[model samples]
Target: MGSSSSPSGGGGGGNGSEKEGNSSRPRFFNKKEKSICWAKAETVPGRHPERWRKDAADNVVCKRLFNCLGCLCFEYDHIIPYSKGGESVAENCQILQSRVNRFKANKDEVDTTQLKGYSCDIKFTDKELDIIEMAVYGDVIRPGNQCRCRTVAEMLGKYKSKDSTAACKLPQSSESL
Candidate 1:
């Protein structure tokens, strides 16, 4: 599914301004590109949860608190640093926890060698991936942006009760998994 050209059909350079000979800044991922990236990232086994939950108890003390059902939130991350010339494509984006994303910053690429160790039996449909991405990245207060979790919960249907929580719980040690 890799394309030589960007989804925008532009093939200049990382900044898309190579042809013009004016390379100032890297090009930002458009909405559609971001969506595609998020969806593709979600399909990876052992990927981080698309959303995170901070219960009311946890929210009372957390530094950055969100007020959704169970304080659900999501963050979009670049797998490779844009500053390092990583294109904003599906293969180079990931959904990460807010705290993890903050700690990661524009440092280095995430190591995926360990992902093979995690056994993930869950399979998400494209629509489900889209909803999860929107819930985590979309502005929650706006009319259309509100209640993304509810939409996802509905899509999950029977599995709603079982998978409602999307917390990012870190393993304590290599043996924890």
Candidate 2:
């Protein structure tokens, strides 16, 4: 939050030549790094450095969250999970309903080793389905259904265009459950 009166003052050259050790100019500063954090100081006429900036692509929905039927509003939620080595990108984030987000968060806190069938469909073996009548239920309870509502269908339609391969696949039937 410090400011200097001189344009070439001792703090550091906000605008200086980067020709190695040309002068007493601070060696640490660079033009690109300065641009990223540079903000207008309210008290003065000079630029102040900041830690965060508004994203240029703020209008674009995160692809992964969009695919999961998430609205572009609010912070995105990681799908595969950052704890499991997922990266922080739109492609990895899934939009979740508030109720579902709460349920998943609570579920994560509990040990489900004794809670049989908690694994659900995606994890269930196709072979296991062949032997059980309830396997049909497993196939329907998709991870995608967490955001069940009209929003889900609308978002799914937009996402379907980009993910054409999955477009024809029928939604897992939730009627029986």
Q: Give per-residue CA lDDT, model 2, range 15-95, as digits (tens).
A: 334322444433223444333222311111111112111111212221112113222211223344433443333343332
Error of 1 at 11 (Å): 23
TM-score of 1: 0.35
Q: TM-score for each prediction? A: 0.35, 0.19
* Candidate 1 Cα misplacement greater than 4 A, ranges: 1-26, 43-71, 112-177
In terms of lDDT, which candidate is strongest?
1
Q: What lDDT score is found at residue 26 in candidate 1? A: 37
Candidate 2 segments whose C-alpha is farther than 4 A from its true place: 1-75, 106-177
RMSD in angstroms, all models?
Answer: 15.1, 20.9
